[model samples]
Target: MMNIMRNSKHPVRTAAKEASHERIVSAAARAIRRSGYDGTGVADIMKEAGLTHGAFYAHFASREAMLAEAAERACTESAAIAAEAAASVPREQALTYMLHAYLSRENLEQVERGCPLAALGSETARQTPEVRRANTRYIKEMVDLVARQSPDWGQAGAHERALVTVATMVGTLLLARVVDEPALSDSLREAALKHLPIA
Candidate 1:
């Protein structure tokens, strides 16, 4: 039955389905970041992608499946920014540049376009295993990327420090986003920059 369905799909139909799936995943990524995984709904995602609610099942088996894909998509973009920053700057200053970018006021305000680790970290505790697994993998990817760029890459405690750096950055942003006052928010970000090992 599976083979029959695969063989019956025309090339054009396959391409169109792939395109729709991409659209749904992209929309879910942004929506989940902005509104959260629990807050985002299939109806809203489909509508945001300019498709009907009924079309969701055609693209995804379940909400959790879509959430897993969305988490992976968001985390991939987050990792890319860190990796690129690490590559672009001088070895000694690579982490500094990445830290500055990660803790920037602009990044803090642009949650929908920013790191999934910060945006969805707390929420993932209540998520499915697949979603949690994807988040964990991407987080490790970001940590490894930063660790490799460290001056003491292979030395003892280098990876631990890298993990702390990533955690501090993400935690600071998450705290900054939750505060009611703008002053407190700015202070949180500044404190993270001042105290974090971004030298």
Candidate 2:
């Protein structure tokens, strides 16, 4: 028997739908960072994507599904940015460059475009498992990235050192963003940047 549905698939329509899906995910990614998961609504995401609210169902099964994808997108972006920052310097200085960039004033104020872990880590803990899974996957990738930049990349304690480095960076940024006092925020980030055991 012939498969009618398979035969009816249109490449152009598929491409267009894929583009729309990208737009929706991108918008949701920014929204989640800007507004947090609980604050991001379907209607706003759709509107930001320039999509009709009715078109959301054609892409995702539920809000949580979309949020999961969005979280993944944001994390991927954060990893890429960190990689770029590290790549711009020498091998020995890669970790230092990345640390400086992450703890910089520019990243501090760019919540919507900053690292998702620092921006949404606390909120993610209370989110659905699917969303947490997405974040966890990227968090592991980031830890590996830091480990690779270490002088003892393949050594025993490299992974543990990377874990502590990531934790400190995220914690520093999180607290920097939490305090209303600009001086305190600057101090928190500066202190972390100074004391981070980069190699």
Best-matching candidate per TM-score: 2
- Per-model TM-score, in order, reads 0.92, 0.93
Q: In candidate 1, how many Å is residue 146 off? A: 1.6
Candidate 1 has its poorest 10 consecutive residues by lDDT at 148-157
Index of the highest-lDDT prediction? 2
**What is candidate 1's TM-score against the reference?**
0.92
lDDT of 2 by residue, 43-68 (tens): 99999999999999999999999999
lDDT by candidate, in order shown:
0.87, 0.92
Clashing pairs in 2: none
Alpha-carbon runs more than 4 Å astray in model 2: 1-9
Give the per-residue lDDT of model 1 (tens digit) for 112-185: 88998788768888999888888889888988877887777887578888889888988999999898999999
Displacement of residue 199 (Cα, Å) in model 1 is 5.5
